[model samples]
Target chain A: MIKRGYWDIDDILADEEPIMVQVTKTIKGAGFLNPESGELDLNEHTRFTIPLWLAENMATRELAKIELPKIFGESYLNILEADPRIISLKDRSNYFFEVATKLNDFLQDGKFITPLQKVFVARFVHLYNEITHNSDPKIIKKLTELERDIYEKGMKTTREFFDWRERKFDIIRSAQHVVNNAKRFKLK
Target chain B: MENEITLPESEFFAENTKITIIPNFKHAGFQILSGFYGPLRPSVAIEVPLWLGVFLKRQQKCRIIPPAWMDLQVLKDKFEEERKKEEFSELDFYYMEVSSLLLAHAKEDIPNHVLICRLIQDLQDLRTSKIRNSLQKITVENLYANFKDIASIELQAIRRLLPATYDSIDYMRKTENND
Candidate 1:
């Protein structure tokens, strides 16, 4: 019943991130999804990269099987387990958490379920501290799109509360959408 | 998910908290939508919502009586209690909004308002640190967080973060049957 990400731009983009899968059943006229393939039909038992959403659908229909991305492998997770605060996970994928979770849903072995949870919690705590005692704005560079969304929300509330305490609420600010609208329709 | 109350909205709700004020001018009472407010008698103390009290205080028609916890002694003790306790000691749910409104308009009514402000800031900082420190105990297995005495404003602070986390975790844990 949950209708998530129907209009979420980040969710849409996360669905577009590439995933590698091996074809079990050859598909005709699907090779254009990967232009480098150049073939008219996708060949069987050969590996190729495709958008995650296509891979998920193909995977569920027994057309292909997902190969774990290098970043989602045991070693990478171990590095995160050692100290999630140290590494910038955004390097692996901007939508690391979202893509990983969606991929996990396809995993029949459920290998990613526990480690993904552990990684998330660890990163979440680190993100929590940084938000409260934030000295650096560049910290967003390290966060995934998901964490960045959470961070922006937390930072907004923190700033609002501080403004309230200092009685510096400048109520004359225009909403971002209004500003964007005016920019779009500005007179020459 | 869209239910988190913003600062202005929370403040508007906090306006409903009752406080005592002594009227210098005569007024029968108010019959506004929320409820009926005091039948004001000159020099006689009457209880009314903070919004009405602040309104009357602004026009110099009434002297606002600072809430019990607004005193220096009470705040100092509260600051100490917050510093010493891991669990949040009880505070008025609308403490932040109420105090800000009072200090902004009715500063002359409160004795040692300066020190009280300082103490409130300290208390807020202590509780904020407490909330942050509790993050260490959170893990995949034990996300059983008890935010018992956290105020609305403070909850508003974490509302976006913790719920998003819970949602992501739920997404990752999605079972085969759910689809």
Candidate 2:
């Protein structure tokens, strides 16, 4: 029953730069081609950029290691630490929070979070706490408005992206179920 | 004081709703707050309530052919003409909602749907950027006054960005006052 707007996060993330990852083990699989660059072949110890969703899948399966770029490096942390203003951070990097969280999720199993991403997340958490728990009513109202914007726009996109992936997986599972049923019947 | 207070208009009108079904389907009549509507048939044009039209359109059961005033050409001309005039022209109250509804639901039915969507989005972006630019120089007294002409949905979109904008502006104002 939820009404989806055109500005959802899946659409936004689709337009964002793909995350770069290095192949730890050779992945000889069909449909692993970089859709944008049309590079189908992936070899061991080779580095390539893929969409965030795909990169997350590969990293989670131990097929690749995520390489956090320099923009998400210590230098970026220095800049954010100096300002610590929400607007300034938003202007500097629109996808920083999204990218950080995605990377954190992908690397959770291995505890592979980068030093800079760690710092940024900690800093953002502090700011978020202050904005939510502020004493001033006017400030609270304004901050709530801002938070609503972020949640509605950004979170919706994230939800839609994951939903599409889930639906795709559902189709695959159903097909596998049918195949398994067919094999069992053949044995009977 | 009466002149200064602009009355908010209702977002949708049920009486004026009409739609064309692209696919075949049947539905039993349903009761709504306004009245009863339905028994919809495929490939046939029917006049239903606005809520029914919207629901059917979202389900891809029908396409709401836009009103004459909501034509892409008409909107484009109006937008261009408004940009040329120093004074802003009064627009339909439901301009934002109607256009967005059509773009979202009846995309296949609308000729050049992509172009129309792009134009509407560009126009909205221009308006939002202008509002943001003005917000940079706004005072608390003039904040509501500045948004008097914007559509309700457009205003809703801008409200999200206002908190951060207001925060920065308020900070600057306080610092200047102190100085």
Candidate 3:
């Protein structure tokens, strides 16, 4: 809980900077506002959209020789036959190969959103490599590069988004706190 | 109208979702969700739709395994735990994962899905964290408010999922710009 008395202020005083937590909060609060349009920011809402991308990456990575005993007992192919998206990708080699190329290009030249989407891509590749370590060393080696880049981009984008949101929400909450305190002061 | 409305089936709990063993047995389907799996066994893996995948991932939280802000060392530990346990048969894992994933992403029933996920995780972790449970309750209430934000017609789905809170209340319809 990092508790201390006022006398311990000397320890923090030598740090030579006002604790920056409040400033970060203010920035995050303001982040919910759009700079160009003066409208409510919508990008902050998109964080919830990551699951589908992660799932897609998982499905494609582990494609072929996949049998779903739950969906259809030993007839996994029959279920995929019913669902189009499962069979859309040709095969594992082609799917991962194409994803690697696409991810490399995006990392090299894509916008902020591209990197954000690739976070799940990296996780997928890593999981596959972990599971198939003994059998598919070659595929794991190839995906390692893609996984590293995608992971880095995902982390950066996630940090920026949260930092921006924190700054915006902090100010909004603080102002409300101030108003309540002021009303109490008047009452006193 | 009472007779006509078809109920949405949870794919996760359906009888159709089954598993089978080959060569040794002719007719065996795995029913892991309703059935039990012993600790340290492999479970089947199910393939799910894209939308569902996104939904389940968000619901996963920090317990023994790391949450979104999990440390590398903790993550490594989780990887080891995953390696050691082999409860979910390949097929059961696929179906369960996919169904849970899809249920997580189903926007109309999101609150319910989120509730189930959090509750289930809590159950698994043997956690009694009030903050976690309260946050879920708050989300469910917010989901109720958001349901009212949409057109009244869409409210029916929300009502079905949240019958106790929503059944008695009537939504205030905002005036459309066209009106």
Candidate 4:
């Protein structure tokens, strides 16, 4: 199967988290007021946690600046450096790409990327290129094996999700097309 | 330089799976992954793999006849039955993908393309409505249960709305807990 570099929107939506941000300008929240929190009353330079979805909106309007948490800081780079497996790298690449694209879209002029985010993005791009272009036979074989393992796991989960035997059979037959495409990859 | 793989559209279907084709010209046979497929003769029906069928169909060399299960009457019946149930009826895992492929790429070959399209749309609308309704009433445990029945394509279609729906549900539950 031909692998394409694309992000799954469903996966992104499912993975959103609350993130801390420093308010750049005092702004009263409109529809986004969390009823439990009463109302969003922000003052310039104050830091607070907001859901990432909401943060995207606020950041776009220049109301706040994202504060990279510990997870997305030096620790992420350490994790990638420790185990640069294709699977893990692919996951990190997807995550960083999604986050970066979202933030870049919203970021105004004069705002700059955090030092850690820049390092993470640079490392991710370097690793992504290495894996995509590597000609080593052993690495290619391992990548192929990992692809097969992912397909099998996906199919198994899909099967367990459905209740009817006939439905399971039908899904397997249809999903075979996807599995076949993934299995037929040729390293360039 | 790293080269990203680009997939041809037909890669969405299982390769080497047999499909019926009606040819319009005479030509020499060719070999493929599974085996060889024929030199063509006009008006003759032959079984060939999905890849060859797609290739021939694209070149306008032959017309592809869809599988038996893809019949308009069968699909209509299934759609009607599924519409009535709170849960979706058992269907081929590839039913959505294959039907879409036929509709998009081989419309002329389907005798009742209009009817087929309408039935599929109605069924999809019903499913989407059911899912939306359930989303409003969801609990954490039931959220996972509801997701199991959603097709990948359906999930893609609804991805934009899901985060907000999930957040509202989570907020409501938390408020209830406090109360």
lDDT of 2 by residue, B1-179 (tens): 12211112223442244444443587675677756666666766666655567677777767676666566897798778756744334565556556665665567777888877777667665664555445444434454325556765445443433454445334323333332
Query: Using DockQ as the measure, which candidate wins?
Result: 1
For model 3, state the Cα shift of residue B78 in Å: 6.9
> What tens digits encode model 4's per-residue C-alpha lDDT throughout A86-108?
43333333343334334433443
Q: Report the number of backbone clashes for model 4.
A: 5
**Model 1 C-alpha lDDT per residue in residues A1-188, reported as the tens digit of each score:** 11246797887888899999999988888787657779888889879888998889988899998898888888888888888876898989998877776776667556655787788888888888888886498989988878888888888888878887777652667877899999989964
DockQ-best of 1 and 3: 1
lDDT of 3 by residue, A1-188 (tens): 01123564422221221111111111233434334435453232221111222323423543211111121122533443344222322232222222322322322322222222233223333332233222332333343232323333334333433443233322334555798999999998
lDDT of 3: 0.29
Which residue pairs in candidate 2 collide?
A9-A157, A10-A157
With candidate 1 superimposed using the best TM-score fit, by how many Å does residue A73's alpha carbon deviate from the native? 1.3
Candidate 4's error at A182, in angstroms?
A: 34
Question: Model 1's DockQ?
Answer: 0.55
Number of colliding residue pairs in model 1: 0
- Angstrom error of the Cα, residue B89, model 3: value is 19
Instruction: Note the Cα lDDT for every prediction shown.
Output: 0.83, 0.52, 0.29, 0.53
Query: Per-residue lDDT for A102 in model 3?
Result: 30
lDDT by residue for model 1 (B35-140), tens: 8876889999999989999998999999999999999999888888888887999999988889989999999999999988888878888888888878768998
**TM-score order of candidates, best first?**
1, 4, 2, 3
Give the chain A TM-score for each candidate: 0.84, 0.46, 0.18, 0.41
